[model samples]
Target: MTEGKWDEKFVVFLKKYYWDDILQLANSYPDQRSLEVDFYDLDVFDREIANELLFNPDEVMPSANNALQQIDLPVEKKLIDAKVRFIKIPNKIPNRDLRSKHLLQFVAIEGMIRKATEVRPKVLNAAFQCMRCEHVTMVPQNEIKFVEPVECENETCGRKGPFKILVNQSVFVDAQKLQIQESPENLKGGTQPQSLDVDIEDDLAGLVKPGDRVIINGVLRSHQRTTREGKSPFYDLVLHANSIEYTDLEFDELEITPEEEEEILALSRDPEIYQKVIGSIAPSIYGYEEVKEALSLQLFSGVAKHLPDGSRVRGDIHMLFMGDPGVAKSQLLRYMVKLSPRGVFASGKSASSSGLTAAAVRDDLGDGRWTLEAGALVMADMGIAAVDEMDKMSTEDKSALHEAMEQQTISVAKAGILATLKSRCALLGAANPKYGRFDRYEGIAQQINMPPALISRFDMIFVLLDTPNEDMDSKIAKHILKSHYAGELSEQRKNLPSSTITQEQVDGHMEVIKPVIDPDFLRKYVAYSRRNIFPVMEDDARDHLVKFYMDLRRMGDGKDAPVPVTARQLEALVRLAEASARLRLSNVANMDDAKRTTRIVYSCLRQVGVDPDTGAFDVDVIASGTSKSQRDRIKIVKEIIKSVGEKHPGGKAPLEEVYAEAQNQQIDRQHAEDLIARMRRSGDLIKPDKEHVKVV
Candidate 1:
């Protein structure tokens, strides 16, 4: 008989007799060729029984026969043990819609996640993507094959997978799941939607074909939803992941050198030079030494690393000022934005939600065609994004922001397109208090129009208040007047040299910057932090304070944020004092380095700690309108005050109450007392001829 005919006959016979058994026996077979030997390649299905039973495994449980009881289906190749059901959650397929994806030019795909569902008998499907070689298939179930399930179809080894399981078990928040019966696994924090586009439908929809690098913008969510009878329990899909995040492309961009980083940082370090740059604009943001330091930390770190989100901008910094107008907060933001490499200024109230993360609806010449544009965050990637009037944005805008700020990405679903885009930018935002002034007595949550959960995400929170002072006002007035008039002067006229520096200058420095320790340095620093910083103990908060010092060292060595040894501890030690030393371009982190970082972090942490009696931290310790750290300090103070009066009330709390407030606010003792004194003198509180005081 001919080889093809012989193979065909073998396949027919196998299908008739052992189709189910072959699938069941798939586990036992060394490889497909084990069965392939007998049937050859006459027909694709010549090995159908083996393919399913061996590879697919719809016929058996486990290894056909085991203690776990590899129960095989009836008429299966392997031995049957008992009745067993492989309960799996279904995943979603790649995008099936094109009109919504809105494919365009110069798009770079960064990442992807699964859209969650909250229906019962939930189908756990494709809300996230895991690559399995050239055969990129999305499995709704968590059990997507990690091993290569097939041979390379081409000359190259095509049938390969990630060699790993990419799981993003970050805190998933699914409210819809809560309404239904949910397992402990589904009940993660915040029912939060995932980020990035995991699936695409077509080329036109920005769904570049499988393996075609693409960027998409869409709301990515992880959820649980009930499926119809006879199907899996939960179903998951990448609902646009949604935004203009996907496009057919990749980027191998250039970077600047360390020398350039050193130069820029050195330039910034000099108050004279730094002041010369923004002196005309931000001359009078007085007394926020820590705030200025934090800003400087972010500024140098961001620029020093030649990339955003580095040590300079850890975990995506976000700030909101709840102060009365007239504070130099806006001025500070303006100057910083201008100093940044790529930044855009927008108001919270007027900025559209979509406009902040993405852009659409541009008319193309007379046609009804719409153009897609990157939003402030997307365009600001690798840079900084500044927003003012933050309280004015709608709740929808705020909700949309929650994911972007944390995950460093955004999803969009409007203008007939669903997509996700990169919004990995430093967020420096400002807002006025609901009372139009710093309400030292209220919860920070209530003062601004944003969620506590969102507020908690910021690395540091500083309140900006228009501290009433005659001398400071005079200085601010004179400075503003000088800047206002100086604005029209040309670069030469001002004798300030150049108004702006080009990216080239920055890049030139990045090119030569050598890695003192490389990424391993970060690992060593993180290890030190975990060991020293994570431990909670009783040592006057000093011995346990190695954590803070270690972190400072890490930040210092990081060139952007730099080294180790001190951050793991919580008590006051170094950072605040050394300040920018950790961000120095040195290859190694020294003791002095750790000390510097410790001082700054300590000050910020102390000012924001809680005071139990007062129900908040000693916020008054850190004055407003100058430093961003004070914002967080105020937030802690507000929470402490709100909770304290409710749980344990006195008509008032004493100076020692600052200690309790510091504890509650996670601040240092010194920070709390400073606030007590400041508030008392300012008359923001009523000190009834004694140590005890209350909000005025």
Candidate 2:
């Protein structure tokens, strides 16, 4: 059909199906310049027109806009430049699947916004004035290159040279560029994700930001590849976006069938559900039942609270594992990533601060304009980010995680771009001890390479020591051998004929190493619980948590006693209890949930927060890198050095004299020497010579 016929059909279709919508648009003109038309509605009206709109949007779009302009309305309410945008396009395609056939075709693609450029005015129509004739001509701009009038339309003057743009008469629209990447959850088998550039104009320019998951309905357009050599035969694809729909809910992408929902509900009702979940996580790996239990709770995280004051308290849990070499820390992290609804795994040795958080990068697709690019944490929003070799990251780079872990947001103010991106994900970080082996006698803050402030933010810190024990070693060896045997048998069965290797024999071997629940089912269960369950703490549960916290605090009531625990631990306990209730699909967190969380918290505290010298629970060891007893002893030693230095000529106390005075004050000689060495390393004391020391 001709363009005029298409316009007439669209006008009739709109009047029949969208008359009320057109009237509403007429009332809200200028502010809302675009009218969204559903593709399904268009299909219902005329199937051929719907098909043409998807295949030849460039031809049909303008005709639809012309039809919209022809609609009858009040004299002052008539729209001249109103747009007709299509939504719910059925031709959904993945980023990697887009090809030449899809170019210029209307399609819907869903992904997380990996990068977005700032909105800027783009010329849509350029009015050129002939310098010689002083006549203006209007030209529509479509391509990347600016267009100018070919020749003057004056009856006598037909000059083609020296045309200048009339700035006041040129039409401009707000335009922005975004790079959308395949959502991490959608990629499988370690496949690298692909991204596509999207151009949005007018009302759609500033509606989305980096880290937002959206489905963009647009027409795919191709641009010739250009380099320093010249334009190449190959072309790059870009989407001309018409509408943006946010998939903001964490589990919106996850689809649970009715049968699967029944199975999930049945699993939640199982009396042994907790044990089954713990056993399902890296079942091939031996022992650390408590650690597995904590990890299970982390999967069904606490409810995020939004206070009336407009501040948000994050419910996502952050956990750290400090262990020796040969442990299964990395394996556990990998398993968690696989089980999460959306996950990203990155190693600190390879990831920079920007790679782990967000970066302001120059976008090649946007003519070298600065854009905000999301990093691992941002991409894993409402999911899990498993970071291995966390200690390998530089202190400067690790500092970037402080805000992301607590506030669940990454604020970037670099390269003339300032933006805050969401990183509302649980962090499962694995680190190696500074000395390559965890020391039970030393504080966790001293053994781990991470800063004390950062370490303190973790809800739980587990120390996996590779201690040599005959019974435990034997068990671990048996488990590893069984896992290998299971794998060998499975491969043999696959290669051999059915008669040679019976299925029952392979199943017997597999049972020893197989997960109690399938990983895929576990992932769906986690997503379901996170989507539906928001457990409220019952009074009994609240009391249980308060009582536990008060009892710990009572241990440090004396004037000189160390603080047993802080309010942070209480908050962590509450989150854990809520997660426990969520795991059961319960609406209320009761005393049982509270008790379970308290037990886990107590165990974690005993491992990392105990003071070696005082043999007491002192959370200061983890929170401040120093126990209260150690701090007091250091203070006494400093006083002794000051008093003894006055008698010396250089005001530097002799090492032997300071130690003697420290011993006289009841501080151990060896402990005093260690304290002095620690102070020297920390820059609080300077060794004037080998035998003398001076306070800085």
Q: State the C-alpha lDDT per candidate.
A: 0.44, 0.89
Candidate 1: where are CA atoms >4 Å away? 1-281, 284-287, 302-315, 359-372, 413-418, 477-582, 589-598, 601-696
lDDT of 1: 0.44
Residue by residue across 1-696, what tens digits does model 2's lDDT show?
Answer: 899999999999988888888888888888888888888999999999999999999999999999999888754677787988888888999999988999899999999888787899999999998999899899999887888788898878999859989889999999998889998768987789999999999999998877777999999999898888998999989899988877653554677999999999999999999999999998988998999999999999999999999999989988999899989999999988878866789998889999999878778766787777779999789899999999999998899999999999999999888888889999999999998887776676677888888888899999888889999999999999988988887888898676376778889988987899999888888888888998999998899899999999998899999998888889899999999999989989999999999999999988888888877899888888889989998889888888899899878999999988888889888889899988888888899789999887
**Per-residue alpha-carbon lDDT of candidate 1 for residues 590-629, written as tens digits (9 for 90 to 100):** 5544454556555554444333234333322222221334
Q: Poorest 10 consecutive residues of model 1 by lDDT?
A: 175-184
Instruction: Please state the error at residue 551 of candidate 1 in Å.
Output: 15
User: For candidate 2, what is the lDDT?
Assistant: 0.89
